[model samples]
Target: MKQAAQAREVDVLVVGAGVAGLSAATAAAWSGKSVVLIEKSDTIGGTAAIANGSIWIPNNDPAIANGFTCDLESQVRFILSECWDGFDESQKWCGVSKETFLRVDRYVKSGLRVARDLTNTRVQTFTQLDKIFKRYFFSTKDSVDSVRQALGPNHSRSDDELAKAACSSWDYHWENKFNKVPYGKHIWAAFDLRLAGKFFFSGFRKHLWHIVQNMVSIRSLSSLADQIPNLFTKFWGFGSGLILVERFRKHLDRQKVPILKRHELVAVATNGDRVTSVDVQTADRQTLTWKIRDALIIASGCFSHQLTGDGVQDSYSVKSSCVAPGNDGDAIRILKNADVQVNQNPRPVLAQTVIQLAKEKNAISHEPVFYFYGDSFFLVDRHGRRVMNEKLTYHDRAQHHVGNAEQEFLFLVCDRRFKERYWGLGIAVPFDQKHMIVGNNESTLHEEIDRELRDNDCDFRLADNFSANLRETKIAFNEFARTGDDREFGRGKNAFDVLGYMKPDRDHDAPSRSMQPLAGEELYACIYGLSTFGTHGGLVCDEDSRVLNSAGDPWNNLYAVGTCAASFLNGHYPSHGMSIGTGMVFGYLAGLHATSNTKRL
Candidate 1:
């Protein structure tokens, strides 16, 4: 490891190379401040590199060609009125600066402009389905009762309960029945509800219901309904992040920002309420201390077992999904050790569930679904007896079934129908099952599975007898579609249970209607051991991106961003693009603030 004899000085030292860190470094360097960015991984992208890369800039964004007549106050009011019920009263009225609002607006405009330019030039495609969906389906009342009644009474909750929850004060008008509780709160609620002998009720139902309703609503938005698929592809399909990251990276490179990869922060040298220097370890085990004369920004990320190799550490643990493996809680610990005031209030609104299963050869032959950031993964038996909810944050999901010592194995049951519709059976494939030789390296699918099993302390078993399970799962799904009862697990058994609350509003009369048109007989199941997404919890910081001491004051020369910084979304993991947006916006704020402070000095 090489050591510098003379101390290096920088305007800012950004820890972590994820979205937040990159954003901060980019902004700071662009602002004419010398900056140093460090990352534990050799790669600079962090989890965002693998992310779907959608930033949820609601209401009017740059995507709209004709400028809207709406003002920021009006727009903010409209959004708050629609989504406010889920927020605390204080947060509901908390006004965002006009500058911040405009920045977001400009970002939206830039994003849309890039999309349009790319699309016109055939680099990419852009679609505005949300507008289209709103235009066609302007109905404000979101009711699943019709769907429930069509399914059957046994599969669903009483119309009265559904209406009560839907119409209650808790319902945010725009979000419909979706509650504002943080993700952590929701997961804890699920665990508590389950322990109390509750069935058919869980947060998973609410989340899925929200997605279904949103999808249906988005579909009804415009006359361009025919183009909806293309729009969705533009937003969620692979390589979506390429445009955004590429544009941003270019901008930073032009500004001469220094991005240091594969470096981890070990300690902070502080001078009473301010950070003076940061000690970092590189991939090669070399340690370097960089002195910051102006400010230090921390965007490390939340602490999690997978990310930090540390177990659950707080009440917020329930809501955290796994993040990148390199995300340790060092950022938070360092700040806390410096006596920064942090928000330790229990987040009780977040909820999580995971499912685990294996794909048959037909389902995934070309592209395998990569699990990143610990989103939910569900493994359902033929009867949809959820074998696992793999998407939830690690601790909460693991605790659900870890106690069952006899549960040595779980199943991921899939049929020919599932394979045919979602992904072509011939092209979709898991990385573990492919046989290929590339760059002088030869590998086989079976070897990959064996290695994975061995590393995770488990074994994989293929089942040939999936016919019975498929029939049972199909029958249950049919029942659910027709009656909304979820007879197998009582999907909507309780009003407060997160899952139960999301019971599909079915048409009770159509109890025998099949949800899927494909046959289940040809499906197969693969069993594998489970793993976590990463970890959550990091250094606590305010919206300005300044690292806060335990006393709640900003560490004068320190700031944090990205997963390393405490999240603004709290516990709820919104759509794919939400976090990236948060990282970008906050990072920008931190950079601007840090640079301004530097100028003052």
Candidate 2:
């Protein structure tokens, strides 16, 4: 045990350089407070960098600028339909509690305001998807198929093109019964269309209305051509997440704030309820102490890495995570160690279904399978029974797996045709053979699947009535293929479901573009696990983002934002960038509130 170094005082100390931490640092700096931003890793962007970088800001600036409006009550109502269960006083909205309702309301308003602020300050910019398509048009002479083939897998597409591929419409949950305003809330990082003119033509050739309609037609046709896989771009692509981080980093650089890397929070010292100082370990394991003059904002993200701890060991276990390393429940552990009470979400993980592929014969790696590219495949339980709408959003589908106790594991059973045509486990597109259990025939596939299940160390096994159940499942799937309607789960019943099935053919014989006849030979199956990009549970906090103690009181000069604080969403993920959006919103609030008070003597 080395002795701790001398204490250095700072007006503000922000843990984690992820989106939330960056936002906090930016806001604190804007407030004219001396700030120290520290990250456990060498890189800056946390999970945001690894994701699509779209932020689901209801009533966002771009939408408002385009003459779209979503009232506060409607926004709150839409959220209630997505996440909450009970009704409020009016009995029309999700009425969890007054406090909960108010919190949700605050989140909506704050998220909108933050988007506007970021845009105005040029710290971060956003663009609507409809406008992105209208601004850029591909040549009709080349045809969508020819262009896609000409530009191979490694083809360079602008960030905006990538966004268009990922999200053609913001109508993800329009099918949900309680949604009032669904189309305008979804937004992505803005790019200069002027710079992206090469891939798609620069100027609008036809009338404004005609060009817009033509763009829509082209988008639909492009979708038919399978021009894009979900949430992916070719080569070392320039994603929106990178764009978002770069802008934030530029702002921090301009502010002259120092973002110290390789600093891991080890010990936090508290004077009663207030955090007075924190001890951080350097790369060489040297401990350095920093005294907090104003506030300590923890935005280090969730505990996807930390397997066992006070708030973690007993809660639900996450099967897999794509979150950046260093999110090892450091904040929760340190806070609990210092006698602070952390809030625990019963269902904490933001769910995403993943498959564990064999990196080596003995080593396994997780690959996210958020969407099944074609309609030819179906998912089933150990008993060979369909459990969910295979077309549901990753969060929704993964939630089913997380909460379902009877189904130990689900298998994505697809034919060779389906496998060859589109992607499975999207991030690692072109699924490796090692990632799947392949069989030449039905009997072999069944045997291999059962063998894989029996060998699973993650408490998964074949059901008692596996053989009988599988035959019935196959019969049902065939019936679904014939009718083009998944009567049991409503698989292809929504706008989102239609978007996921890249048609890629003007004249196909299949009844539904989302579904096709299964190939007779060479089938594949991969075990799906309950996965998450990050968790949303942490210390409970107020609207100001101040952490609260056991008796429900704010700890002076201490704050938690992003995944460091309990998520206001409760357990719902409304759209693409909810985590990043809410994180920045609360982080901004935390930074401003934390700096409002004068420094302690």
Candidate 3:
């Protein structure tokens, strides 16, 4: 006998409790509608909880209200530059004219208008946030100095090399926001959107502690003076998503909204391009059918790990993504089944830290997804050659790792001094050294080599397929110690990297702007494998986040947001938190749009 699905009804059904889904559900509830928010994971927040939680909303109202400069034209140009890859002017919108079609500029404008009106409270929190965040860039001493050297008082602002060389060290985009609809395509690198509210909403205390602890060395005196006053007026949570989640979740609760966690969305019941209901299998294996009375909003995340099947393997297999496992392609599958077109969009190279587990396992019990290892770190291939610019952006580094032949295993070499400071830098938040190789600093090189005689066949111990790597690593260590540079690989050249970051090293002249340890710090190396942050692929949707059919018409009331839908940048990573920002804005739009259907009836 086939068991029957227990039927229920809701004004709005939101799948996924990630930042996007929560934003959507919250928006709908705010519209005076009953909303249901669900997550496949046991807990809320999704990957956003573990993430650094930086949301990049350019030209945001908070930034504007605070007198922060914004270069919207530059941001839009950069966003659309990559989008023009497969674009055909003759069929720019495929019969949807530029005036009526969701042009990227207009699309952004609409989202900004909605964001300003939809979440005024969230916007207020970021005012203090921008003040705290602005200091983080100025604290780094070297890159700013480099910018002065590269761009003299007379040089043109359009120098690309100077921008790359500057390593995005300064807040240069604020130089003149009043400038014309900027012709610059790479200006996003210079702008700080100031919308990364998680740092303010939650990480403020930890950040203050971090700043206070490092005050004598690298912290900014002025930033501390400017920000301390604001702290007395506000209370914050642990991070960006949690505080908002607490707020949104509470609002939903008061509105009689039921949030079903441990419920996996299984199938969508559609009728003539409209979603009629959603079938979800609960943690108890009970199938519950949510009959949509008004509209269905799919805020499920990207097709990153979690669920597996035929289609997902294609994108995720090429490069693995790092996010909560709950982001299976449920929304992608549902919409595809309804005759919607899904693009398996290819993105530019994104860098991610490829860590090799000691147990040859997939996950670490306390993995630090956001923080990078320190100034002493550098990656080496099997041949013991350095990888290019070890400190480039995580996605940039990850892209290089994907293309590298020696990506299966690379040595993550660090000195004892750098190792000692790992926890402070958030290398692994709530740091745990459960699977580390600690070389002896007190003993001689020969004596230390003797201690590794009984080494296991772990990747770290025998990285080059040798019986043991003590001899190979010891030689490299000595060379790096004496030179204070990786001459073979030019390792510390990126301004974005901690190693390359210029500190006031009065001890050595250091021929270039990059930094390195004085040597003899003792080796603490680990083998790492290439990893990804997440994949950007899924069903196609229009400006309002409405699911579009093959003929380019909206699918009645079905909508897709977050990772479940393709990124607005066409899978390309535009800046630091573009993914989260776009998802939230679109999710906000979807919820508002879905609820408007009720008003029409």
Looking at model 1, report the run of 10 residues with the lowest lDDT sum.
Answer: 182-191
Instruction: Tell me the lDDT of model 2 at 21.
Output: 95
**lDDT of all predictions, in order shown?**
0.42, 0.64, 0.52
Q: Give the residue spans of candidate 1 off by over 4 A.
A: 1-7, 66-174, 177-236, 305-323, 333-336, 342-412, 420-473, 479-514, 517-520, 526-536, 597-601
Q: What is the lDDT of residue 138 in candidate 3?
A: 25
What does candidate 1's lDDT look like per residue over 161-256, in tens digits? 443323321111222222221111100000122212211222224234433433443322331333334322212233334444554555555655
Of 2 and 3, which scores higher on lDDT?
Answer: 2
lDDT of 3 by residue, 1-601 (tens): 1111223777788888887887787778766766778888888777666554555655555545433334664555445554446443356552333422363554456545655554554421332243333333222445444454434466454444343334432221222233222111111111122433544534445446543443333234543443355342222212554444455566566666677889888888888987888888889998887788778888877765532222333332232345676665677666555778687653422333324332233432213223443454555565444555555545555554453454544555565444444432224212233334545442232233223322433232233433234345446544653565656555444333432232322334444343345246456654444444555667777877787788888888888888777665654554555666666667777887888832321
- In candidate 2, position 487 carries an lDDT of 80
Q: Highest lDDT, which number? A: 2
Better of 1 and 3 by lDDT: 3
TM-scores, all candidates, are 0.56, 0.80, 0.72
Task: In angstroms, give how far residue 225 of model 2 lies from its true place.
Answer: 8.0
lDDT for model 2, on a 0 to 1 scale?
0.64
Candidate 2: give its CA RMSD in angstroms. 10.0
| Residue 155 in candidate 2, Cα distance off native in Å | 40
Ranking by lDDT: 2, 3, 1
Best by TM-score: 2
Per-residue lDDT of candidate 2, residues 329-447 (tens digit):
77887877655567665345444434344212222223456556566678888777888887777777776655455553578888655554444334222334445678776567778
